[model samples]
Target: MTMINEPAHTLPVLGEYDVAVAGGGPAGFAAAISAAREGAKTVIIEQTGMIGGIATAGLMSHWAGSAASSVLQELYKRSTVPDIVEKFPWQGTINPEKLKFVMFEMLHEANVHVLLYTFVSGAVKEGTTLKGLIIENKSGRQAVLAKTVIDATGDGDAAARAGAEFVKGREGDGKMQPVTIMFKVAGVDYSRAVFPGGFEANLDVPKGKIQDLSRQALPFPAGHTLLYPSSLPGIVTVNMTNFIGIDGTNADDLAKAEYECRKQMDPIVKFLRDTVPGFEQCFIISTASLLGVRETRHFVGEYTLNEDDILASRVFDDWVVLRAKFNFDIHNIDGPGLDKNGAQKHFPNVDGYSIPYRSLLPKTVDGLILAGRCISGTHKAHSNYRVMPICAAMGEAAGIAASIAAKEKIAPRKVGVKKIQDVLIARGVKP
Candidate 1:
């Protein structure tokens, strides 16, 4: 590594807000809207042109669970495609474009300020409390002051920059789950396609068969491949192709992963066109603008949710959010670990578990809270709660807590759990 010195210059200070959200993804969106609706002067900063992070930009067109929370339920209802609602409780395939529109509308109605095409480059902190954030955009560097900050970046970017203790990847070697680039193909014949259980059925193919097919098609490593029908007819989204041993947080590794994933796309499309029943005429429409990163940075919070908590379906006294009814889905760090078998650890008897408010409060950071997949949790626990629906729920809880903290002029950690719980329950979050 090398370093270069540049002349120091003061950055322009942007307006202050009661609550500042650092990401525009599912968690950020929910946090901003929830805060604003609670009468807090909130601002949501996004690096992209539009909101809806992975769902819109990453091209993940499916919502894995049903209407668990009011905010999620509203998003499902506003989806342009009606069929998504029909699938309820199972899996809902959404129209990404529609989702972007719906999010914008919701934010507008809540009167939340939005800053698009802006990235949080650093944070200004006084000890454990974040006083402001440094942002960079086309307009150059600037700063935004806030009473409380919500880290919904999905990577704990703000928390990490604020000097919060964090961990990345699995326990032993710090190896993370492989990243995938989703692609869409058009000209599929849905009628001829054999989707026994649904579109995700493509992922259920046997591992041996997947390996055999990958070898026959090309030299690319055999991993998991999944295809799901899109909102539009004659089109399908592919969740195949995995780039192993790539560190998502490293710039060099991310660049390499992107290049390698893109190179593997052609062969995958060809494999589908030649062998698949309905994709004979299908061609690559577009690949995701961003790589689908499974795990990156997990912040250390007041309490770390672990594998035992998930398996036992633990309930917290200071419950602040809800997660979808799913399993501990830890993807293999090396190759196609759980992708072949589907990374699901089912809790058949339970609906879902409650995430304690303490998990969102960083252990050492005062005036800051974490949301999305980056919240305090062990690798196994994160696998279950990292999905979009659950992330949104966590964001909603963080927003409510942040707003209350701002109103009372107290640190986020001092906000009462009972206050947050009452508001969440009223907002349609189940206890």
Candidate 2:
């Protein structure tokens, strides 16, 4: 790598905020809403035009883990699909468009300033404290000052740029879980569909057929194709392609991954229509706008959540958030073997685990907090907390913590954990 020198120039300053959140995914959305509801002048900067990140842009139309947070429950209630309870009795399916609108409505109701199509290039820091953020948009480069900053970028972008220590992928060769591109197919024949429990449960479709398809189709890491019924009738979303050994944070790798994943879609779609019964008349509707990066940078926070914490269902004294019943579900890091039978560790008896407030505070960054998958955790633990529901819960906690810090003119790490927990409890979140 080489560096290029450029002439210095003055940059415009955007409006100051009490709490500034980077990323507009489930975590960022919840953080902005929670902070604003707490009377903090909050602003959310999202690179994409829409607020719901993976759910809307990535076409991940399913909600995993228990929807325990009030924010998630509210979004589910606003869903356009009636009888959601009956259709998805356990973890509900989402209509992405409906979710986008609901997120916009909630953010507006809370009066949270949202800057879409804006990218946070880097952080402006003085010693260990982050002073402002360098943002690039259509108007060009500018700065946005905030009393408290939340790194919810999912890749620890803000924290990493602020000189906070972090880790990427698993140990050894640093291999990460594969990136995926989800697509929707319309005109599915539900009446003729032979899915017993659902598409995932259609195991009678012969293993030889899937193995043959995997060998003949475009390079797909997942040994088997998986589909889920969407909120729309006669429509199903496919999660069949996985691009292995690609580092999502690298621009070149992401570009290649996106291209290769799209290339794989046509063959998979053809195979589904020709071989699968229900998809005989199906056609590809649309693919995700963004690549689904399963694992990436995990910031080194005040506390790093480990496998033991998750397995023992540890309750932290500085509890600020909770993750509902879920297991360590690590997808295959490389090559094929990404079926449901891939590497997984289930906690069938455990109810849930508490995520300490310390995990959201970067070890060396002051006035900075983290939300979502970027929070401090080992690779295995990150798998469980990286889902939408858990990320939303973490965001809500980070937002409240940021609000308290801004109000008291204190560092985010110094904000009282009990205060945050209390606010969350009042807002119908389990501490």
Highest-scoring model, lDDT: 2
Worst 10-residue lDDT window, candidate 1: 196-205
* RMSD vs true structure, all candidates: 3.0, 2.6
Model 1, which residues run further than 4 Å from truth?
A: 83-91, 195-219, 337-342, 345-350
Clashes of 1: 1
TM-score of each: 0.92, 0.93
Cα lDDT for residue 157, candidate 1: 87
> Which portions of model 2 miss their true places by more than 4 Å?
83-91, 194-202, 206-218, 339-349
Model 2: which ten-residue window has the lowest total lDDT? 194-203
lDDT per residue, candidate 2, 87-180, as tens digits?
3423368778778888988999999988999999989888889987999999899999999999888887888889999889885667788898
Candidate 2's error at 244, in angstroms?
A: 0.8
Clashing pairs in 2: none
- Per-residue lDDT value at 163 in model 1: 92
